[model samples]
Target: MLILLNILSGVALLVWGTHIVRTGILRVFGAELRRVLGRSANSRLRAFGAGLCVTSLVQSSNATAVLASSFAAQGLLLLAPGLAIMLGADVGTALMARVLTFDLSWLSPILLLGGVVLFLTCKQNRAGQIGRAVIGLGLILLALHLIVEAAQPVMQGEGIKVLFGTLTGDSMLDTLVGAAFAMLSYSSLAAILLTATLAASGVISLKVAVCLVVGANLGSGFLAAIGTLGQNAAGRRLALGSLFFKLAGALLVLPFAPYIARGLSFLIANPRESVVTFHLLYNTLRCLASMPLIDAVARLCHRMLPDRADANPELRPLYLDPGALSTPTLALANAAREALRIGDIIRTMLDNVLELMRTNNAEQARATIRLDDDVDQLYTAVKIYLARISREQLDEADSRRWTDIITLTINLEHAGDIVERVVTNIQEKKILHRLQFSPAGLGELEDLHARVVANLQLGLSVFLNSDLKSAERLLAEKERFRDLERSYSYLHLDRLAGQSQRSLETSALHLDIISDLKRLNSLFCSTAYPVLDAAGALRDTRLRRRVLDATYGKDAA
Candidate 1:
């Protein structure tokens, strides 16, 4: 029971440890990664390099592979580049395996302590991400220690030797076993480590052990299969493509098992050499088999996972394609599209909300509420798209720009949320009391709305054109909106004292509406910040902070 518990505990730790590392790396450079990958054109060689470099930095090719699957799922990356990246990620894994071979115990504890402190104390930025990266690296080293210790007993036990022998004795059976085994860990790294240990123990022939490793490649695709569940047509196709790649690799290599064996045989005297040879052979074979026919594989994935009966039809920016990181120009384009989409939704919401404020008709408010779904949906799509982007490969300039986008999107979403919330409040107040505002109060609202609408329009232009000049003008005007709201806020309270009870209530309503408008302008200004940052604006911490605080609010959960 204790042994089983230890194994199970080790299993849980592996999952947690893997998550820690993946999330930490994402924190360190997620935005920049997405920018680069989302922007890459059809340059297969660049895609390969991106995959190798990104996974190498990330310290986990499985995470990178999962990222590619997400892009495919979102219709961002096609099969060719995705496959090329997969090949590169495999090569990247070999790099990580080599890193693991080094005894880094001396640094692991120090890294863990430092990472925990940074993660706890710092604000959200690249610095905070670095803390997470350190902690994840430390945890990974620790998890490896536990796993290696647990495997020691098996290495010495005759039962363990026999179990491994049975697995390797038959190529077909062992391949299935290996595939299942690797899939269980959700990591080819863990699978490779196990194989290396088995080899070092001399529990089985090199040929049999290599066969298990081969099987483990396909095993890693198990999660890809599970990912297809509850996803849309495009998402399913991407997931299926991942599975097919692994299975196809398995099928192709199984036939040439002898060739694979021959390659590893040359390294018998050197275990390190054997490990290297096995890694090279497995990835090389997998890549060669998949490369020329990547498009065909993509087409098959499409056919297998057909479109759903009632798919939500919209242009969603699947932003996280790692191939994009290889091309900053293309990433910039994708970001433009996503920003445009957000701007369009907010603009439309504002237009209808204005109608509600003017006419005071329930129908107008109903229409405004109806548009809320579109805003919410687009928000979800953009957030996920950004999350999928690979950040490690970005240059320093791009990294800053990418982080700015994250802030921009959050501001946009908050802007929309404020609009939605105030609109709902207005609708509720109207439905309950049916109070009409005085002409002066309505005029105040119209003036506030006009300024906010103007800011939104200018901010959209600033974002699309990368125009800091327009953005600066908009930022100044955004400050002027504060003056507008202050005038409105004071005027409404004074007038409410003379008005009838319903009129008094309407004045209060006008004050709230003007406040919300002020906030919307604040968000719009921040939204423009990313474009300015991308365009090389002088960084202003106070200006950025004031608006960001208004948008997220100090009390925001």
Candidate 2:
């Protein structure tokens, strides 16, 4: 019982160390890693290389898989490159496994001591994150030593020998046991390392270790698939494609496991070196051989998991992933993307309103008003998703971005309400009453509507990119839109004074539509205020300098 407890403690420590390392690395270099993956989509080889490099740094292929799936969900990456990246990630993890098996037991304590000191001194900066990763690496080394020390005594028992006797001749059972270990531990690298340690200690034979390695790879595929179960079709497709590759590799290797293990044992005298070398060679050869078939596997995955055409997609929040809530940066990015979706819906609503005004399609008008409900639903989802993210985890910049996302979502929801109201007024006062504006008044409304749409596009651009020039232009358009609204209102009154029949009948509706458009424009332009204020381009108020000086002394003002 004590022996079993020690082994369990060692395994738990190993798992916890890897978790610390993965999260620390992600927090320190998440955005750059994402950018690397994003830019690598142009070619399969480049994407593979990027994945290999990133997974090497992250120390977990599963993390790479999640990043690729997230990009695929956002439609930023295609399936072929995503599969290629997963293949490379497999190779990378295999290499890391080989590297970690080295006899570096002496360096673990030095790392732990230095890491703790650095982490305590600077707990919130990039250096601290580096220290955190260092601490994790030390824990990993220490856990490995502990596992080896604890396992030797337990494996010598008669019960352990009898249990291992069953796995010697059965490749399938060995593979399953290996896969179960990987899945249970949530780290294939750890599983592979434990298998290598067992083999080195003479607890497991060479053939069993090789088969277990193959099974561990397949288990990682299962992990990726299970992790992305809640994601969209695109993400699920990426996972499925990775699983296919892993499954195919496993099928090819399992039948020849005994023969391969014999050949490896003959060439490499050390059992531990043989196991790690086989893992590396298996992944490298499999990934290279499977590279050309990425397109075929991707196509098959797409066919298997085709895009789901939701009955009401607009009512759902597409980019607000719940899994990302633990990573504040990723959560913020997801929220920002969902907020942009709201902007697109608002743009569509405005376009529909214009079309209804032009053709007076009452049925279409009713359909357009329903879009607001979708906006409201999406807005509520984004709000709740952002709210779920723990603010304490966010840095200063990420906190600011969090504020921007929520603020934009709020403005968009209000804009949706205004559009609904405008559509309702047009439906009741104009369409039902069979009233039309004068030709000149109608032309003026169309012109203003076009400008509002243009500004909306610009505002969304500013919100996404935060370009100072674009933000300044968005603010400038606000003033221009206000001027046009005032001018259009005067023109509507002029037409009313001339006793134009159509203008008289729809006089109230015309001004109301104009006012609504102005309000919508204001809401859209609200995205610029934060950008300008952050850049120090915005004044405190619209009051003139002379008026401020008159109210207070120059220094006070």
State each model's CA lDDT, in order. Answer: 0.67, 0.87
Per-residue lDDT of model 1, residues 1-557, tens digit only: 44335545655565566556766676556556655555552787788778777777776666676566656666777766876776677777766766764567677789889988997786355576678777877776675566556655655666666656686557888788777777777777666655664565455567766777777777766665564464556655655665677777777777777666766776466543475467666776676666677788878866787766554443344443333433443354456567667777788888878777666677777767766676667677666666665665454655555656666667677787888888887887754567676778878888888888888888777755667789779868977888878877877777776765656777556767877888788778765655554455636577655544544445321
Residue clash pairs of candidate 2: none
Q: Candidate 2: TM-score?
A: 0.91
TM-score of each: 0.64, 0.91
lDDT tens string, model 2, 46-146?
99999999998888898899899989987899998998899899999998888889998898999899989988897767777789889988998998898
Q: After superposition, how far is residue 510 of candidate 1 from its true place, in Å?
A: 14
> Could you give me the TM-score of model 1 versus the true structure?
0.64
Worst 10 residues of 2 by lDDT: 544-553
